[model samples]
Target: MTTLFKAPAKDKAALEEGAALSPRFDGSGLVTAVVADSHDNEILMLAHMNEEALRLTIETGIAHYWSRSRNSLWKKGETSGNLQMVDEIRFDCDQDAVLLKVRVGGADATCHTGRRSCFYRKVVTDGGQTRLEIDAEPRFDPTTVYTDH
Candidate 1:
């Protein structure tokens, strides 16, 4: 079953050109990566993707991200079953970045902390002390959510 979106071209030149023109990570031009939701409209996450990760994501139809923390490529939902199935990919005007719209299957929430989104927390200042406030609760628990899978 095809999702409702168009996949980006797989040309090497197009991919390189697009990634190069993407917004810089440290104020220097460098296209990292992008991810969206099933509808191909809502942006789900923004994480860096190396060449291997990009290739794997494209070839496998699943989201693969370069883990700056783990220093390796990570396949989304490998452990949690919050798999992000790639629906489509598109490039911005400058071809320096791309947007991946995906369909998340099973009980997996997008956030590593088990929230529906990675942006679940909001910073709030209480009595001059900066604190994190939970924007929402987890849609499902990582432990029991994907047991059937």
Candidate 2:
């Protein structure tokens, strides 16, 4: 694999407020990523990426993430049929976060629960209690798709 451009050391001006693509990874060597649909710009999910995952995403034009639960690099929708083809990748001013606009294929789903987006639930405060309400139904049956999980 080709080495990506090295991130410059944290310099207040360059790191926090610059136009350069000098990503500031956290102690775990990971950066936060927010993904959304390219057409509608609907938020899909939030993930993390390591150096390799970030490099691969830029090189391949496919969304890739570092799975904290699995502790490995994962191509989004590798298991399910909904692959995300990156259309545009943007970094925050601090370069500590990324935003991905992607066109999805197959089921056009992004959540592991077979939902179109991971943010399918809305937080509601009812009777002075916080709760989640499902706003969207599953696009596909996760029980049938994710048999292993």
Candidate 3:
């Protein structure tokens, strides 16, 4: 892809409030991406994006992330039909991270485990031990949806 966004520069004003989309990637050539529901602003998932993923998302107005586990680029909901359509993209103070407000398409789910959001579990302490509590129910069935897990 052509260079649509410039690399982060030294100008404070430009870095903070500039028209140029200068994203500061980490040493791994990644920038943290936080996805949220556009209607309710509820956080869906946290992922990372390489330059190629970032470019596709911007060009297509869809959510694309670099799958660290898979070590490749993937469009969210491609397999499960839970595609996230970009409504807006915001950057952190230093531009090291991004927040994507999206309108979920298809099943309206974000997690591969068949939940509306990846953050379906809540951390809890019980009997002096930390555990996860199921805060949300599964919106779909992973068994029928994903084959590889």
Candidate 4:
């Protein structure tokens, strides 16, 4: 697919200060996308965007991501009905990463596990034994929501 953005400028000053949306995709042709809830500024998930995914998200006002495991472009919450309606998008100075402020629809969940956010655990160290503990409750039942699972 043709890219909507030009190749990122090589000049450090231009890349950092210029008013452009030229994303500096990594070697894998992807940029990191950090998604957050627009309402409370809660981070929902961390995903990646290929050129196509980024274009689609910008054009559609919805979240789109490149699923590394699936190796395909994915529309966020397509099956789970928890679509992220993007309110704002911001990029870092170098444009290697993006921050998406979105409002979730439907069950207000963003995780395949039916949680509001993908980060539902907190790491703790008990006597040098590190473990992850659940920090959030599931907003919906995955078994009832995801038919293919």
Candidate 5:
């Protein structure tokens, strides 16, 4: 059977170098992207995974990310229980970014405002005036979605 985690031929050298030089959380500047997924192609969410997050994701099969805004580590669905179950991870040819296809579990949406995804809204210009409109309703209310523990 074919393995999903096999290193690409092109990335083999870099992976080896990274493993040797910066093995553990040294941020080797390799692995520029992470594409997580469940069985299907539904994208639960998309986030940048740094070296630490990448290692953790590979080790645990859970989505971990580097929060640019929070400037810290973030495990997906930690607070909302809308966990992203990673089925597979893939990289682009250039290894610049990742496409995360994941299974979104629980009631919470991927969007911060509690929408199904951050792409829930579509921008349009009316009479040459740009206006933001509600293209889609929130999949679930975050307040009720997450119970206090």
Candidate 6:
């Protein structure tokens, strides 16, 4: 693949203030990616990106991520038709993380579970026990939408 990003600046000043985008990847060669809805700013999911995923996102204007669980690169919603069209991309001052504002297509879902967002559960404590409560409804049925699931 073609090289699209510069090597991270060694000096803190250049890294923080420079116009060049030099992402500081972690020891695992990945960077954190926070995705959100462009219109409402609803957080959709948290993902990771390797160099290639970042490059593809920039070039294609679509959100691409590194799947730590699958050990592979993933194009968001490629299978379920929930593609995330990136509206904007921003990096933290330290360049260790990225934020993608996007518009979701199809079912407007971002979670593999067919939910509108991956963060569909809320942590709650009841009777001294911690449990998860459903905060959002699924937009589509996973069994019907994703044959592989």
State every prediction's TM-score relative to the real structure. 0.65, 0.93, 0.93, 0.95, 0.67, 0.94
TM-score of 3: 0.93
**lDDT by residue for model 4 over 1-149, one digit each (tens)?**
66689789999998999987799999999999999999899999999999999999999999999999989999998988999999999999999999999999999999889889999999999998999999899999999888887
Query: Which regions of candidate 6 deviate over 4 angstroms?
Result: none
Q: Report lDDT (CA) for all predictions.
A: 0.68, 0.89, 0.91, 0.93, 0.61, 0.94
Off by over 4 Å in 4: none
- Cα lDDT tens digits, model 2, 67-142, are 9999999998888878899999998877889999999987888898888999999999988999999998888888
Clashing pairs in 3: none
Expressed as tens digits, the lDDT of each residue in 38-123 for candidate 3 is 89999999999999999899899999999999998998889988898999998888899999999998778888888899998899
Clashing pairs in 6: none
Better of 1 and 6 by lDDT: 6
Model 1 misplaced stretches (Cα beyond 4 Å): 1-30, 122-132, 142-149
Better of 4 and 6 by lDDT: 6
Which candidate achieves the best TM-score against the true structure? 4
Cα lDDT tens digits for candidate 6, 20-52: 999998998899999999999999999999999
lDDT per residue (tens digit) for residues 18-94 in model 1 = 44433222233224667767663555577876656666777889988878877777998887878999888676664
Clashing pairs in 1: 18-95, 18-96, 22-96
Winning candidate number (lDDT): 6
Supply every candidate's count of residue pairs whose N, Cα or C atoms clash at under 3 angstroms.
Answer: 3, 0, 0, 0, 2, 0
Worst 10 residues of 5 by lDDT: 17-26
